[model samples]
Target: MTGSPAIPEASAASALVFVGPMAAGKTSIGRRVARELGWEFHDTDARIVAGHGPITEIFAEHGEAHFRALEEEAVRSALTGGAGRIVSLGGGAVLSSATRQLLRGFPVVLLTTTQEAVLSRTNLDKRPLLKDDPEAWGRIYAERLPLYREVADQTWASERRPKEHIAAEITAWFRANHAPAEPIHGEAKDEQHD
Candidate 1:
């Protein structure tokens, strides 16, 4: 991590969008938050793998551009349809300007942590960007930091903590701001931030 100033938390959006580097706890946190809110949970990476095939194979056969195209479609579909759901995007999903634009009215949470924190969580063999290199991970994280910040309505550190606690914080925010009419939207009242 560079010595940049910490990003301030923003407010409000139609749905919750989680963005960050690989192994950043997006899927786990998103799932817990969605379950807490009784809404659906969608992970764009999972969708891509399900609909197309292995992402590595896609990159091998076609290219990164083609895989990103597929990602765009999956992200778009989830955004347009997810009114009360939590969405977890692939680490690089925000690289596209159009995707960033689409995220404007959505509650984006940038889940970030130091490389040391993610070392245990990371699956080196699977991520093309990291290529199992710690330095490569840092470089890519530095490159994507600005893009992640651009769309994030909130930012949270998931290092050495329970994902449920993080999910609870996000759930509190979503409930405070949106207050969805449905019974399953939770019963919290106060708005708190850390």
Candidate 2:
């Protein structure tokens, strides 16, 4: 965020966040969108690895809750800082109540893909929750859909199309939905989370 877009002066709290199921191209889209807007791109999962150890190691030694706590703090720091940045959150990041509440004010874009579409791209070895089975992927997607919907400000399907196209569409959506010159601000407690 050293060199920024000419939009306006605002705190790093105004970052655009991407949330969705694993392998839904959240990282790819976030990076493209950030580049499109001349902003920095960050991935929460990568941050977790950098701050802590490997995620599976954390899950093995500490447990999911401990890993989740780390995720919560990472999400908080990412949001509280980095105004001209786009963040791709881990699939389970929104599971934290604090993360969900913190997401209330930001533009949380939910990217979705059909099970068939992601099959070729998703690496089961990397995603422990996938359990090396497509059924498990489906089940997890089903379980997280409601929570994703609850926090999403907008939704887009990341089908078999190119990543750049999806990113361009998101950029257009923001241009149409968000005020051109206004800075994205934190939500007032009196206002609705949407």
lDDT of 1 by residue, 1-194 (tens): 12322222232244678999888899889988878876778788888888888888888899999998899888877776635667789999988876777677677889998888776667776887666465677788999999999998789998877999999998998788765455445332211111
Error of 1 at 115 (Å): 1.0
Note each model's CA RMSD in angstroms. Answer: 8.6, 8.9
For model 2, the run of ten residues with the poorest summed lDDT: 185-194
Give the Å error, residue 4, model 2: 28
In model 1, what are the clashing residue pairs, if there are any?
Answer: none
TM-score of each: 0.84, 0.83
Q: In candidate 1, which residue ranges exceed 4 Å CA deviation?
A: 1-14, 181-194
Q: How do the residues 1-194 of candidate 2 rate in per-residue lDDT, one tens digit apiece?
A: 21322232344235778999888999888888877766677788888888887887888799998899899877776776645668789988878777787777677899998788767766667676665566687788888899999999999898778999999999878767653365543322111111
Best prediction by lDDT: 1
Report the alpha-carbon TM-score of model 2 versus the true structure: 0.83
> What is model 2's C-alpha RMSD?
8.9
